[model samples]
Target: MGYSRGIGIVGLGVISRAYLETLVGHADVRIVAVADLDAERARAVAETVPGARALSVSELLADPEVDTVLNLTIPAAHAEIAHGAISHGKNVYGEKPLTAVLDDARAVMASAAAAWVHVGCAPDTVLGTGVQTARAAIDAGHIGRPIAATAAFFSAGHESWHPNPHFYYLPGGGPLFDMGPYYLSALVHMLGPIVTVQGAGSRTRSVRTIGSGPREGETLDVEVATHVTGVLTHASGALSTVTFSFDAHASEAKPIEVHGEAGSLSVPDPNYFDGDVRISRGDGWELVPVSAGYEHGSRGVGLLDFAVGDAPARRASGELALHTLEVMTLLLESAETGERRRVSTAPERPEPVPLTTEAEWRRIADA
Candidate 1:
């Protein structure tokens, strides 16, 4: 294994900042290059990191020094960028949903398989202390024989703050697709894989008006459902209720709650790295100490996981993303068809990440 993994990043967008913030000074990986449609944007971002160079997308993919590609592009471009990296003989770690479309995701997976490279995607938040601790509790029998789970994420439209809120309303972008990965990924971590799903969805308005940025008054057409509710049947015979929405302004429900035979666990937001995992065993809610998962983890921990291993790290594998994508997209399908849909794809439950203090992980990385 190499002392430092060479990484080239593509799509220097808003989310890219979070990854850079996490990976820039980390010892496990080296940011060799960066690229974006706006060359100036990539250059600006690269300048902040020592030894990182700004390159064109194609050049970055082809750079022999780049062992992996960190793809931070929009949903539509995910597969294309990932395929490009794989074709160039580099592993790829990308943002969520895998691809905007299922067929495209399949193609990307097949391509990586053929090339014998690795593909990983986001919502690695599942590897963080919050979800990991929850998983640990379940595995340790703290929550005996999990029965049901609830994943709720309700919030106002992103147009209220996002400068480029237009994408959230597009076909691949919706309340479900935009935020469902986090919820679903956490559920899978706590329970098991989903086997079937039935759902109902609705759209609030035909258009949304931006409330911030220079384009504050601009309107974007709503091309996808705003509210989605579903029931997921897990392979373990457990059922998980999912509620994701961008049509509402507030929600009093916990982000996620998993109920088992012995007790119920309140999991923190899957979009975040760490938070308290509370459990209730009839007496009252009590905090479960952070017993497992990465401490002080952040956005790029998945990429960092990818970097430390020879193969695509299971903690953030593409198969996990594929399962998550299938679960979410099927919810939309079931909503449209007004019938329950069986999920044909079943990704293996990613191995649990043991409690590893960030400092220890770094020490091992630096060794």
Candidate 2:
């Protein structure tokens, strides 16, 4: 593929900054335009990039120069934004959980397919060193046959820091939907797809107060779960205990671990790329030194790979989006139905990509 000049970004929220910073110095990519419901936010982002214009969502989608639409809208707007982009013949790059609803996610996937445009989802953090390294070790049989795994995501609560914390408590924005993608994506990467799931979840508190930020001391009406715990049975016969929580207080550690018959692999926190990875061999776990690489904002890396023609078409395809949505939906379904939920669909695992190349690894590690 030829190099893409850049992609247009929609929704200039907190995450867009990271993508911009990462794209600025890269030869393969650029941000050619920006759009947000908030015009000021779009203009602010446009100011940072050369010749980049701030446009409305319609204008961004219609522009001939915009090859892909980066959909960073909130959870509620994800599917609609993606639908609009696909309708206008632009590929889409979306934030995690794909869409708030499973059926809508399927519709978006179908639309993208008919349009022949790609749709990629975020938490492409899985492509980073942390996940890649673990995948490589597992493929090399370093951990032996996978048997069981555990993943935990915990936060005091988002009300503490998010300027607008109300959305977080809504149906599409709880701990399971918000933070579950990173953990689920990592688990799928390491253990393959889950065939069955059983879960129990609840909101520990009826209302939460922001710990800090402008919203501090404000009360938020809780609509969805604050805590969730589930068991995932993978196609490979690995069973994983997964937990997501907004109510817990605990010391920070990596969010996931995959145990094999022989040993265990501890994954780095999935929120960022290039954290420490360790393998338990014999008596103790040994920290694996990360390879180096340029640390660009997370959103831009996949687009950068696309711009450089280094990745496949639909490289961040909608199918992965569907799979993630299915997993999350099942988790919630299991919690509500009081029965084990089976995930019929699973994300395809590409062949293991090694992290042995010093220069490439350094580029990712350093980044």
Candidate 3:
């Protein structure tokens, strides 16, 4: 597919800044337009990108110059924005979880298919060096057959730092939904799609107080589970014990660990793209040095690279987004029903695009 000069970006929120910084300097992408509910916010962000105009969501969708619409809105609005973009004949790149509701996600997928517009999601972080190196090692049988795995994401709460943390406790914003994509994406990349899930969940407290930021000491109501634990049965018959906790105290541990018959691999925090991939053998865990050619601030650049044909479309595809949504939906289902939820979706394996040299890395990095 031929690359467009630039893509239009919607939602000029805090998360969109990282993407803007990366796009401004890239030769492959141009920031054509920016839209937000807050017109002032959209105008402010538009000032930074050359030839970019501020528009309402409707206006941006109507703009003939926009080939792809990058949806960076909150979880609640993801489905609406993606559907609108697809309906207007523009490809979509949305933030994680795809949508808060399973039906909405399926609807968005169906819309993208009928429109023949490419639909993809974020947390393409797994495509970075950290997770990719681990995947390569596992695929080479360096870890032998996988046996079991464990992953955890624990935090005090988002009320402390996020400007609007009320939504963090909402349906799609809890620890599991908020941070689960990062961990789960890495897990699936290494272990394949999960087949079944059995779990338990609870809300430790109904109300939480903000610890910092302007809302410090302010109280907020929590509607979703603050603590959750589950067992995931992978297609390979490997079982993974996963836990997500928003009520817990601080802890110092990598969020994911995969155990195989021969050895184990420790993945760095998936929230960010680049980190070390450690391996365990006769000696204790040894850090496997792998360099992610891309810089840290370019969070969404990898996906943009894939989209523009500057690099191979190794990640950030719609199938992966659907699989991630499936895993998350079933986790919640199992917790609510107190029974093992069987997943009907299967994993789709894309041919591996080799990144064996510095030049290969440069092709993606420099682009």
Candidate 4:
């Protein structure tokens, strides 16, 4: 069978498994190569994939057969991997936040533009039925003019579950940067671009102990705020109150809620592909039928969307990722300075994903 695109993945971490599960043996794209800092790990992963070989990162980037670089590296390595791919004349798709810092994300965008290669980023969860249905409702005016929104995500932290959870406490690993993309990206899709933001945050603890790994009972220093809250002013004059916390134990807050002149919407968790989207219109809340987005979507769906789509038409384009990154970074910065910050990059809300089944998208991609 002929493959339309070739993917060379760099990074064999936990998240890479999810992408591989979603992409391997697919019809439209092929796993041509795999690379990681750990040569043995790369080879092990490659053995599980057909038509794929383990190569050094540099070799994989320069390989003629690779059309796109799947960067699953840590947040700090996002820009570096993207830059390498762009320099080698390949498209790039990666895990979220674009980069550890906003400036690096900007550089990546500039580099990709100059190279004329498309860039895509993750948290494509918004393209799923959960968030997309809510977006469709808003766009169709099922909820009148959107006026306000509230989004919250709180957790005790990842140390309890993840083996190597040190990054969760680092500069780019805080809850806001690490998980804000899901909620923020969903909000951006549901509402519009954000113009300004005001934020406040706190660091609940200076150190965290690893809970269940070989390194269990070990402790790591915390370098970022553990709890963060902010207000975003969307370009459409809508306000969204957001709270992201690694310090909180638990909360019953909806993942996202948007209020409009006519009604209200309770959006499901943006981290996953599908969930019930409830709407409240004068009466009580009712489940809005899944009206849009890809059905049974998963991690690499964004990459598949990127491959079969032109840059302008891609739902998970790099511009949206960069804007989301800026919003997150500025919000954290605002927390430190006790001031309101204006978001500079205003990418238009990505084109909405219509109700599409797995077979439909795959057929489109295969074509």
User: Using lDDT as the measure, which candidate wins?
Assistant: 4
Please, what are the lDDT tens digits per residue for candidate 1 over residues 40-122?
A: 99889989988899999999999999999999888988889998999998999999889999889988999999999888888
Residue-level lDDT of model 3, residues 1-367, one tens digit each, is: 2454558898887888887766675555667999999999999888877789999999998789988888889889999999889888998888887888878988888888898878878787777677777777888887899999898998888787777788788888788888888888788888888888888888999998877877788888898988888999989899999888998889876688888889999987778767888899758978876743343424665556556743235466666777777888888888999989888767564334344343333333233
On lDDT, the stronger of 2 and 3 is: 3
- Candidate 2 residues lying further than 4 Å off, grouped into runs, are 251-254, 289-297, 306-315, 356-367
Q: After superposition, how far is residue 352 of candidate 1 from its true place, in Å?
A: 0.8
Candidate 3 C-alpha error for residue 280, in Å: 1.5
- Estimate the overall C-alpha local distance difference test score of candidate 3: 0.79
Residue 171 lDDT, candidate 2, scale 0-100: 77
TM-score of every model?
Answer: 0.97, 0.91, 0.92, 0.97
Candidates, ranked, lDDT: 4, 1, 3, 2
Cα-based lDDT at residue 109, candidate 3: 85
- After superposition, which runs of candidate 3 have C-alpha atoms over 4 Å from their true positions? 1-3, 291-297, 310-314, 350-367
Error of 3 at 221 (Å): 1.7
Query: lDDT of candidate 1?
Result: 0.88
Per-residue lDDT, model 4, residue 128, is 94
**How accurate locally, in lDDT, is each candidate?**
0.88, 0.77, 0.79, 0.91
In terms of lDDT, model 2 sits at 0.77
